[model samples]
Target: LREERIDTVVNFAAESHNSLAVVDPTRFFRTNVLGTQTLLEASRAAGVTRFHHVSTCEVYGDLALDTDEVFTEESPYRPRTPYNASKAGADHAVRAYFETFGLPITITNCSNNYGPYQFPEKVLPLFTTNALDDEPLPMYASTQNKREWLHVLDHCSAIDLVLRKGVEGETYNVGSGIEATIEEIADLVLELTEKPQSLKTIVPDRPGHDRRYLLDATKIRDELAWEPSHGWRDGLAETVAWYTANRGWWEPLKKRAPVSEETAWR
Candidate 1:
């Protein structure tokens, strides 16, 4: 980056697998926390003034299932899983660099992102690929776990906006404000693939699974004038079609981490 005279740095690299994190948390800390600090140090040494850190909404923990409360930029950090904890630590490191080193940095905590080129291990692509192959779609515990859905393109747009026009040392919560349960997602995937709902299999939930995740995207929406262009159903259907047409891309990934009945859904 110094050789190329890069002026902007966007850190999106992390060990983001929740299930894998539980199995091996050291890797998450190494990549998500230490790796972030290493990059921040390098960026400062390289004289890179602008740094954008992409984080996850999981760092806020879970909101009450019955409440309308959503996580905001000011929300207190209460991470539940190893993955979330590592990310929260990384977020702190980013802010520390900005405060102590005077590095111009902006952070974004985005909700669940689904779209093309997603690895099959994630929820949307996992269920989509399973439905395409007529395999059992694993559901963690019950379908009551609610998550705010955001198309990957919308997430990209929000990040771009923050990187270009956002204030330094600030954090933004980016989400679609659209929430859905795991059951609904499974049903939709089945309907789109013309598969039977019987393919949905309830698997043992992982330890410390958050019941609901909702983000208050008002800051990004009102301040940055950023909004999600793709709706839930349309984006999901388009994503299903993309995976069906581009089996070659996900097929190899599936083989690398073959989903089974015991596979934990993230």
Candidate 2:
């Protein structure tokens, strides 16, 4: 990317995982922080505008229960994982560059992303494909990890909204506003696959699982008039059916093995 003079730079490269970060903190920082700076530095020198740094809801840490208050653009950074800390650092640096250099940059923090064409390590396909093959689906952590699910199309729409309508030096929170715990999601998968409940396995939980992730997208809605078109239920059904009919697509990828958790993929 540095070799080419690009008009816009979008940084979506990061090894995002809470437990993985705990295992190797340095690698997370190296890619998330150093890579971001390298791209931004090159973009600034090349006169690139409209920088979009993709971020995640893990930066918000655990949200308190009994409150419907979704995170907005003004939420403070309280990332619990090394992965999230690195992303949070990069997010801060983007703001700094825009403020100090007057660069036309936009930042958007999003929630758990799940859909078709996703890597098998992520949950939706991991669980769905495992069930499809009658393999035991593992659930890491307490299975209560609350994640705000968003279809990949919804995320792309939100990013498009930010890229087209968001002002410079601004950040938007893009999410599906539909939250679910890992346990509930596992149940959904089991129900979809017509598998018996005995297939759900509770293994050792991943380190530093965020209790709940929520996003209040009123700002984006009020500004760009964009909202998620796919509800979690509808999206889940479609996702289940997609994996069922497309066994040839995900079967080969099953060599990677099933995992405990990650952002939404269904």
Candidate 3:
């Protein structure tokens, strides 16, 4: 704690909920951008090298659009929400540290993260917890929001690659082979929850909701051989089973608060 025993620093901490950002843009910017800077300043003061900046694909925004291309490390940043814009700013900050100060760092922009221990705020767990509790599942916008999904374990593994084997001053995209729409995700959750028949609730949409997000992981794959072992369907099933079996973990969360109607949809 005193002399920088923390040789490697990982910066995966950020306010990442897209819908939440729409409701409170100022909070999103303050936490995601300013928080990252605060960490970087601390790491710089501590003389830490081997920093890993874990980021998301929403920085690219709207991959389902006819004009939107799959996001690479070099793609132009066109973030839709305050959440993503903040991350984009943080990404630039890391790059600056790498170039000017020569900090040993790797930036990994990854696909949608899913797996165990994920809070119910995210899409997979959110719908799962809500539907399993027999609460109506609130969907935002069109069921067509597409995202490339990666299991949390796989995502952590990819971060390890960036930490250990990834090249310094380079950015890599990490992704699973599967992609799905929001509606399809809801249907899957319903099937897993055993058709309660009354738990489906589709709302209008979130304001400025990104239509699709896709990450191209060729760099991570070709460079570090980071391939995914879980499919969207398989991972969804496994995740559903975990939440179902471990009501002890999620019940408190559902009981603690109701879903925010303000951030529910557009």
Candidate 4:
């Protein structure tokens, strides 16, 4: 940063797969926790004017599926999985830098993102690619694990808002205020691809799986005037189409890092 004279830094790096974190947690901590500390130190040394850290809503842990309550900026950290715990540690470190060294920093906790070029290991890409190849779409047990779906473009916009207009030393929750079950999303993909629903196969759930996640994004919306322009179904349709047309982009990635049915729970 000193050599380049860059005034801003936005951290989007992380070992961000929940199931993979369970199998290999050491890497997650090293990358998400220690890596963040290193970046904070570098930023402080460089005297960057703005240091924005992108975080996941999983840092708040899971909400009860039966409740309408949503996670807010004030939500206490209750991370369950190794991935969530590592991210929580990073979030704390970011805030600590602001308080201790007076670094200009802001954070945004975003919901699940799906769109073009998503890694094939994630749920949407996994299912979409499997359907395209006439393979089975493995569904975790209960098939009801829920998440707030945010388009990647919208997530980018929210991060931009936080970097430009957000208050210093504050955390913002960025979401679409939309939630859906895994089963629902799978069905939608099947419909959009004109594939039979029988391709979905039920499998055992991962240990320490969070049941649901929804964010209260009122702070970003009301204060930063940020809102998601994409509807759930429309965004999903476009995402599926992108995957359908751009197999060359994702096919190579899927080949490089294949996610098997037994381990693609994230």
**TM-score, each model?**
0.97, 0.91, 0.93, 0.97
Clashing residue pairs for model 1: none
Which segments of model 4 are wrong by more than 4 Å?
257-266
Q: Model 4 over residues 113-165: C-alpha lDDT tens digits? A: 99999999999998999899988998988698899999999999999888889
Question: Where does model 3 exceed 4 Å of error?
Answer: 1-4, 65-68, 196-198, 258-266
166-253 in candidate 2: lDDT tens per residue?
8888888888778898889989999988998888887775666667889888888899898999989889989999888998887777
Model 1: runs farther than 4 Å from truth? 258-266
Better of 1 and 3 by TM-score: 1
Summing lDDT over every window of 10 consecutive residues in candidate 1, give the lowest-scoring window.
Answer: 257-266
Better of 3 and 4 by TM-score: 4
Comparing 2 with 4 on lDDT, the higher-scoring candidate is 4
Model 2: clashing residue pairs? 113-264, 114-264, 114-265, 114-266, 115-265, 115-266, 141-205
Question: Candidate 3: minimum summed lDDT over ten consecutive residues — where?
Answer: 257-266
Residue 173 lDDT in model 1? Answer: 95
- What is residue 145's positional error in candidate 2, in angstroms? 2.7
Better of 3 and 4 by lDDT: 4
